[model samples]
Target: MMASCVFSRWKIPYLASMYFRGVMRIPSKESFLCSRVMIPDIECSSSKTMWGFKQYHDGRPRGPLWRGKKLIGKEALFVVLGMKRFKDEEEKLQKFIKSHVLRLLKMDMIAVLTELERQEEVSLAVMMFKVMQKQDWYKPDVYLYKDLIISLARSKKMDEVMQLWESMRKENLFPDSQTYTEVIRGFLKYGSPADAMNIYEDMKNSPDPPEELPFRILLKGLLPFPLLRNKVKQDFEELFPDQNIYDPPEEIFGLR
Candidate 1:
């Protein structure tokens, strides 16, 4: 009778656990026991009843996945990140070219040359050019060629610059006033003022020559140390023989 009692006690609990496991769909013996033992301040029930109870108990809301401030959009994020990395105006200019965020070709070309004026990184800039070439959005024009030449010249890769120039000529992309201005500035920056003067002279003979500011870039490169004021006056006189040479408007000086 004692042995019979022990068998009854064990058999009842084992069958109850198995039934619980089946009803709960707990999938494994370990999980079934874990669910039963981990119940907090709760009563154990039949396996068939436990599923609904578990679902009811687990129906509370969890927190959001990302609960911080809202994120900026992709364009804004790129601009903000670029600005943070590069403090210098020139570096920012280069970043704009490298990033291809500009909406217009003229703006992009201007930015590229402006950055090259401060410092040149030909390989990186060329990589940007290659990227531009691949994109259908930015069609390469005379301005692009001119900017590439200027970038190469500033990097002192004169041979490559000349090669690019030749290629431009072969493509029938005639060099414009801006192109000559860039070449002249490049020569002057590299201590080849004679070459710069030759380019300036050639530009003067072109059908459409560059005006004041581009000439100013050439002059600045040529007379970087202490600036030859009289020489500037003489060159301005030669370039604009009829027009009066005076200080421009305050707005033009970027002071207003």
Candidate 2:
């Protein structure tokens, strides 16, 4: 008689019909227990599915898990150390890189080149950078050029800095304020005020708004050249009118 009655818990008429069909034939103790328990299990499992194991309504699974930034791999370490080790022996270094560096992945090559730049191994870093440029995957990345230029400028390798700067310009990459400051300071320190002024002109032409730091650096460096210093001072006053220009006494420039 109970089997003859439709199950109210199963809202679907088709599901209720199926349940009644099974119940009508079977009066076993196990069947009676399963019918009661399995209904809750089906309802709860569908509602409480884990996000990680979730599927589309059509039942397709998600794609691959996301990967984070990878660590510097063993190949990168080996290349960095090898470049350092072979620093004095140019021929041997060439051979070493040719033999081992080819196997390195893109990230590994970038890592090794960056490490070399950090160590101020300008020649090695530049060589590896050129190698990276030759790679099929090499795109014109501003940050890569920025780091190398900064390192070269700090080391007073103006020739290399100029070469990299030209290459960067060819690719339409403009240096940031920090880079312009470092490079201008480098030229001034290298006793090339003319070159420093040339960079200042480029900075003036840059599409990005000029920064105060580079102006300050140029003013300080151009102190010996009052004419040049006056040009920068006037511009500084216009761009940052509220800011005070620290005009050190003329004696500092040995003018007094």
RMSD (Å) of each candidate, 1 decimal: 21.0, 13.3
Residue-by-residue lDDT tens digits, candidate 2, 129-217: 99999999999998999999999999999999999999999999998999999999999999999999999999999999999999999
Model number with the top lDDT: 2
Sliding window of 10 residues with minimal summed lDDT for model 2? 60-69
The candidate that wins on TM-score is 2
Please, what are the lDDT tens digits per residue for candidate 1 over residues 1-256? 9999999999999999887965556434434554757755443333334444432322233432122113333343343335335545766656675564444353443444334333355654554455555556765478778767867776677667767776676666767866776676677667777666666665665566558765676645644332443466577789778766545444644445
Clashing pairs in 1: 20-47
**TM per prediction:** 0.37, 0.71
lDDT by candidate, in order shown = 0.57, 0.82
Query: Candidate 2 — which residues are off by over 4 angstroms?
Result: 1-70
Candidate 2 accuracy as TM-score = 0.71
